[model samples]
Target: MLAHSEWKAAGEQLENQPVAGEQAALNQYAHLVRRVVAHMRSQVGVVADRDDLQQIGMMALLKSIRRYGRSLDEQFESYAFKSIRGAMLDEFRRLDWRSRQSRKEAHDFRDAVRELRRELGREPRDAEICVALKISERQLLNMRYLEQAEVVESFEMLLEQQTHFVDSNEDIEQLEVRQLMTQTLALLPERHRILLQLYYTHELNMKEIALTLGLTESRVCQLHKQSLQLLTEKLKG
Candidate 1:
């Protein structure tokens, strides 16, 4: 969260004398903040405060406009969507909403799943994981939900960090990072690659992606998690 003074400074900057179509662009695209908030609310579920996310989205919008030189275009919309979503996710990370015990449970659950996968030579089924962990199916699902969020957040943060250094004059290290990312992505299955692109690049939620791909939401979630895990492992290697 931004400090009170920081918010005020941002407001003052945006409210200053307009440059040509800046005001018009602001007015025209003001609804984007709301749209982003609504989409994010659905994605994050009810754990996050709608009003707080909206405020963050608005601030992100102001920053995006300034960053893009107050121009409104198709490209600007994509840029602002990513900016707003990134800001909201950053807040979530800062808040650390999950309890300490919950995080531990999630970690244990993840470990159990990985162990079962290694033993089974494939992704473990829900029943297999529940039995192995001595947990109920409901508990297993809850852990999976939490782990899904953690995985997605971790993957996004990694991408954001890597992409930050990508530029025309990027050094060899940065170029290698980019190449590694591309190669890792290419190694994923076609469906996994498509799912990652839709979720991260196109910013589609799980439900929307399920509908688009003609799969159940649960299946989509599974693929999403698997895809991210593969990317994370390969990239880290």
Candidate 2:
């Protein structure tokens, strides 16, 4: 039975992976792994095998632990959530073709992307994907419907209930956009970055950020607007 503080420490340990504390680090994430597996089994249906998911999760945990940092100026949970979910989603996609009957062909396209990356060490270009999957532009465009439907539906669910935002890994396309946003934040001035972080990540109202920063609320609003404009430009670029 891990106490709240214990769990938090475990998270911290996992985040700051050191050679001396490797095993201890693994122990800390034990609970997170178990919880993810149980949640997947219960919520994601029996489409993917339990053992497979666990293995995928362990790989993800390792990646998270290795890449985890204490100083991205964001919550550790937010970063780990994406990594863990991504690993599981990768596994889910790999098993998708075998798990379903009617959608095998459509699912195979995604599976091909996964397999090719594993084999080729990078994602193939659109032409390469078409060649590998034996898919024409028309077929690829049609497949977008299936893919977009799932992405949009999941995004809607996340917006409706923020809790669901941390559930599964986001698709690769969405993940890129998210990474872009993080990079955009890094390019902004420290004040602008702090303002957005406090307002959005910390869920502080504008007034709260203003009070904490000792600025007028209107000034905070101005900074936020500038930050948004910069972020929007970076995203477009």
Candidate 3:
């Protein structure tokens, strides 16, 4: 909840020119964005800069402030929370889609894959798909960028799974999600499973996890990403 003075100041910023209170509000939300981005860095790939995500979240927070009004049913904080998170996720999706091939090209590739799979009676190899599509391997890999959602888990993958297990009308206290989570974690490789346990359950930072695993911090981060990706796949399956 925002303080009374904070709300008043935010309203003034919305009405005035120099964007009063924006800097202060953004400064406060900066911590919020960092937490969100840190959580997301594991879910999404670490390819994006942390600063890039922070900038997108700031933009969304500003937009939320601009659009907010008392006429709406929800409080400003609730609105802003959604705006900030949604903005970051939307930016991630935009980055993913920017490399998309044309609709015709995507469809052609999918058709080629289907045909080759039918002919082979099994999943077509990348080379077979390329030959069937009459495209080089590079082009096939490029097409993969457009089809990331098929191969890699999207950011909302965990959120969707949570919704399925913890609905408004469900039984059992809270062990349901934990049980599911444990089951999924167990499916990962031993190193990955240990890494997740060390970082998450133990609350160790990346640097600490790296030292514990006898790997570099950056390598630990990469392993974190791969582990989550594998866990997401297991959960979805």
Candidate 4:
């Protein structure tokens, strides 16, 4: 919730020089944006920058403030929240579409490994694999990224069983907390969710994930950290 004084100041800024006054409004909006971004990061996963989210949110706030009519009969925060969140969601959707290829590659790699294991009596050596597949190291590495989600426990079996994750009571409770926090995540942009799922569920380290997703490793790491921090805080609560 914004302080009354903060709201009043933003309102005044909106009326004064809507465009030029945005800086002032943004200052106030930053607090609200941070709260929302923090909440979102916890639920889904960090795939977007808090600052980037904040900037988009500010744009949404400006849009709301500019279009808001005295007769709308809606609370300003309610209206602004929807607008700001929508903007961020829109951006997220765009990003999600872009990362689809990496996801497919990951899936295909898993399928290929399963098929190869089934055809061969024993795991093929790297040289035999090269002769059989005729793929370069880069291509193989790309496929390896796919296995991030499906780990082979013994690494010796032709068709390894999927590993089961047994969460501790604490982890289960924390997951519940994260679930509550990320309820709004489904409403977020697709890119944000996809990136988060890949980063968290796939458990791809930053560089590998980045290369797979065509993003900078640093950006991926930062988003990953931010997303984890958000989830931690929400679960703690």
Best by lDDT: 1
Measured by TM-score, the strongest candidate is 1
Q: After superposition, how far is residue 123 of candidate 2 from its true place, in Å?
A: 44
Query: Which candidate model has the greater lDDT, 1 or 3?
Result: 1
Worst 10 residues of 2 by lDDT: 156-165
Ranking by TM-score: 1, 3, 2, 4
Candidate 4 has an lDDT of 0.52
For model 3, how does the per-residue alpha-carbon lDDT over 6-103 read when each residue is reduced to its tens digit?
99999977655326576666665566566556544433343356777777777777666556644434455545655676677667666663333444
1-237, model 1: which lDDT tens digit per residue?
Answer: 999999999998867645666567667777887766645432354246777777777778777788776447678887777678778888888877677876797788768778899999997776777688888865654565676777777887787665644355324544665566677888888989999888766777776888999975656777888899999887777
Candidate 3 regions with alpha-carbon error over 4 angstroms: 1-26, 35-52, 59-87, 97-152, 158-162, 165-179, 186-190, 197-208
Q: Which wins on TM-score, candidate 1 or candidate 4?
A: 1
lDDT of each: 0.72, 0.57, 0.61, 0.52
The pairs that clash in candidate 3 are none
lDDT of 2 by residue, 108-137 (tens): 666876898888897555566678888875
| Segments in model 4 whose C-alpha atoms lie over 4 Å from true places | 1-24, 42-45, 71-74, 97-237
Clashes of 2: 0
Cα RMSDs of all predictions? 5.7, 18.6, 11.0, 15.8
